[model samples]
Target: MTFLSGWGRTAPTPATLVAPRTAPELSALIAGASSRGLIARGLGRAYGDAAQNAGGVVVDVAGMEARWSLDPDTGVVTATAGMSLHDLMLALVPRGWFVPVTPGTRHVTLGGAVAADVHGKNHHVDSSFGAHLRSLTLVTADGTSRVLGPGDELFWATVGGMGLTGLITEVSFACVPVETSRVRVDVERTRDLDHTLEVMTATDDRYRYTVAWIDLLARGSRMGRSVLTRGDHARRDELPAGADPLAFAPSSRLPAPPWAPNGLLNGLTVRAFNEAWYAKSRERRVIQDLAPFFHPLDFVDGWNRVYGSRGFVQYQFVVPFGEEGTLRRVVSRLSAEGVVSFLTVLKRFGPGTPGMLSFPMPGWTLALDIPAGQTGLAGLLREFDEWVAGAGGRLYLAKDARMRAELLPVMYPRLAEWRKIRESVDPGEVFRSDLARRLSL
Candidate 1:
């Protein structure tokens, strides 16, 4: 038996972990473990119990690494489920190609990304990860492999299904073209909630990627103040003369000290940091390397340790279109309550994919990273869930750790349809995670 946990390191559990090097091995393992529960695990980047199963078999898909061919003419690349976006970008970016969608971190595996149906800063212009998936090769519970495409209901079910339907063995998707691995950015600082919304509404469409970092500790006149960062893929001409187009120098990484006090990130410290951060950023345009622009936090390895041993919880929720008021109200409540959130992000999403349980919608979405030990944190989030559901919004299952089961249906209205499809493919629920049990998925 092997012990495993998620990035949050909150609930460590032991399970019989099997690393199947091939698709056939994966199928046999699933078929053999029909009575006992089983779940597929990728890079274990999910922040909660989504990847952990207690007293069950855990299949580590990271070992099934077999890179397939890429059709240059069609701009489609087929690869095994184990591949990470970081590796894929390294292979494709030099050829003037980029991923269609990428989350904030590149450490996530292809299978995990598809199962989570991740979204990025460009969700307003593009969509979730499921939108770019042309097809997938799934290993069903009965030890059979099948190909599923856009029109197939099983494909949509597996997308954002939390790996409950089946094990994804292979994935095929289209890639976007890029001139260089850099971004041409336009950044601005907003005075308050109204100003932030006004600026985003006025100019978000001009850039391919857009996101805002809000100061959650601010209040009164300064409530909801943020720094808006907008950018497009940098063209070759946008770089300085003689810059190497294909060269990507690895950025220096700073490690967080092993032992940081729990009280290090209190409200006073966070408020002061927010003030200095806001003051430092006025409106300006700059060209930055892709690493810093997309994955700034990545420059600090193991930075999650900054929160200490208890870890943190990331609350990401999307409110429906024309419900910006709901977003404003939630931010205001958090600010008034003095919740210390280090990073609060705001983005606008376009239409979602066909995945019944997918997270994105045509609306405004906000995500915050909050320490877990804060008083009444769980109760406060539960109360916010009601507001989110009332506004026809839903929480991102990939980032969720403590949402209640009763709220699942309210958050995902199409859960019934998704359940039907999942049962059709995996009637006995052979694929199960702690998250599925927690939410009764």
Candidate 2:
């Protein structure tokens, strides 16, 4: 048995960890799982318990031999679900192609991406990962590997199902064509949340991608000051003279310190960082590499360790477009409570896919990283959950380490249907995780 936790480093648990090298080996394990059940894990970046199950067997697919192919003409890719976006990008970028969707980080695996139905900065233009997923190969509790397409109900179930229905072994999806590795970005500094939202709503459509880095700790007139960064893949002419626009080489990374104080990211330090960041990100336009624009934190190895041994919790929630009042109230409450969050992201989401458990909708989504040690953090967030549920909004399960089970049905009205669908394929309930057990999912 080995200990495990998600990328956020919360809710540590022990499980029998096994790596299966072949489909038959993985199938056999799933078919003979113990009462605690088993779930598949990849790259361990769900930021929560979606990949962890106490006392159960955890199957890591990294050892599973895999292969992938990319069609330059169509920008379509066929690959095993265990393949990470980092690997996929390394292969595709040089060939003038890029993943159709990417989250704040590129270390996540194809399986995790599908399970979470992740949305990126470009959600307003491209939608979540599920919208681009053409099909997937899932290994069910019955030990059957079935190919499911968009027309199949089972495919939608697996899209944002958090692996409860079964383990995903392979996936085929569409990639986007990129003329250059750099992005032409425009930066704007908003004095407050209201102005930020107004500008984003009015101008976000002009760009293919848009996101704001919020200073959640800012109070008074600047209660929610933010730096909005909007852009799309740069064109060839946008690049400087003689530059290799297709070069996929990202900047070098600096390793995080071996160890830091448990409260290293407390309010004071975080406030200073946020202040400096906002000051540095004045209104401007520039060209930046895809790496910095899409996944800046990935440049720093083991960056999560900065939160110290106790780890941190990533809270991400979305409220519908008309629920701007609720959004303002939540931000006000967070600011009033003096809760400190290092990196708070705000983005606008477009129409969503048909995935029953998918997190995003036509709304505004906010994601923040808070140290778990914050006093009364749980209760505060629970209250925010009530506000979100009341507004008919929902939280992102992939980033939720702590949320009430009762709110699941309220936030996700289709929970019962998803559960029904899950039980149909997993009659024996052979696939489970700590997240499933927590909310009785």
Candidate 3:
């Protein structure tokens, strides 16, 4: 038995791991799955139980040989499920093309991106990854390989279904054309929560990408103080003379220690780090490589270990535009309580995808990494969940680990529709995961 856990390194469980090199191989394995059932896994970046099967079969798609083809004229790429964005960038960036949307890290797989409908800083301008997908190939419970697109109900269901509807084998998506793999970024530090919100609300539309790193521990007048970074892809003319404008080599990663003591990221240490980080910022405009600009943490391999042996919970939720009060309340409460979140981010989301369960909506999203073992954490988060749901907001399933199943229908009104579609395609419920079982999805 192979034990597997999500990126958070929490609630690990044992399962039979299998790697199928081809679609037929995957389909055959599914047909022979035991009563425990099976689930598809790619790159294991869900941050929660979405990618785990717990005693069932885990189809590790990442082990499948990477394959992709790009059409430079249309800037669309058709790639197998196993291909990672990092690999895609290495091949496309030098050719003056870029993925339409990328999350905080490029280590995620194409199939996982579709399953999560991943979004990024540019969500205000562009939608999540699903918006760019032209079509996807899925292997259903009955071992039938089907190709689906926007016109198909099953396609929308699988887009953000967390890999429950079926196993996504391949996908074709549009790529953004770029003159350089660099971003011209503007950085500014806000004095307080109101100022931060005001600046973002006023100027976010002007930039193609924008995000704010909030210091959740900052209280009183400085509560919600943030470092705002906004930018767009740099044009070729903006580059220094003779520079390789399309250069796409990312920096090598430095590995984190194999283990860390629990509570290593206590409030004191986190507060100190937040203060230094906040103070270190100054209003400036500079050109930065795409890797550093979009995926800074990716430079530190296994940085989650810093949260220690108990692991961490990545709580990410979004509240609609008019419900800014709820957003303010949550941030204020966390700050007042001196809750230690080593990494806190706030971003504005634009229109959402058609996927029934896709997380994004037109609103403000806040993501925090808190220690799992923190006192009163569960109750506090559960309270926040009620506030979010009451405000017509919902949490991101990809990052969720400990939300109540009772609230799933409330948070996702389309849950019934999604469930109907899932049942239609997977009536036997052949596709199962710890997340599916946990939330009754």
Q: lDDT per prediction?
A: 0.88, 0.92, 0.93
Q: 102-135 in candidate 1: lDDT tens per residue?
A: 8888878899999999999998888988999999
Clashing pairs in 1: none
Residue 159 of candidate 2: its Cα lDDT?
Answer: 86
- The residue-level lDDT of candidate 3 at 364 comes to 97
Displacement of residue 275 (Cα, Å) in model 2 is: 1.6
Q: Which of the two, 2 or 3, has more lDDT? A: 3
Ranking by lDDT: 3, 2, 1
lDDT of 2 by residue, 1-441 (tens): 899999899888999999999888998898789999999999898999999989999999866786899877888899998889998898999999999999999988999899999989889999999999888999998988899999998899888999888999999999999999999999999999999999999999999999999999999999989999999899999998999989998777889998877999988899989889998998899999999999999999899999999899999999999999999998999998999888899999999999999999999999989988889998999888999999989999998888889999999998888989988999988998999999889
After TM-score superposition, what is the CA distance of residue 78 in candidate 2 from its true location, in Å?
0.4
Report how far off residue 111 is in candidate 3 (Å). Answer: 0.3
TM-score of each: 0.97, 0.99, 0.99
Q: In lDDT terms, how accurate is model 3?
A: 0.93
Which 10-residue window of candidate 2 scores lowest in summed lDDT?
62-71
Q: Candidate 3 vs. truth: CA RMSD? A: 0.8
**Which ranges of candidate 1 are over 4 A from the true structure?**
34-36
Candidate 3: regions farther than 4 A off: none
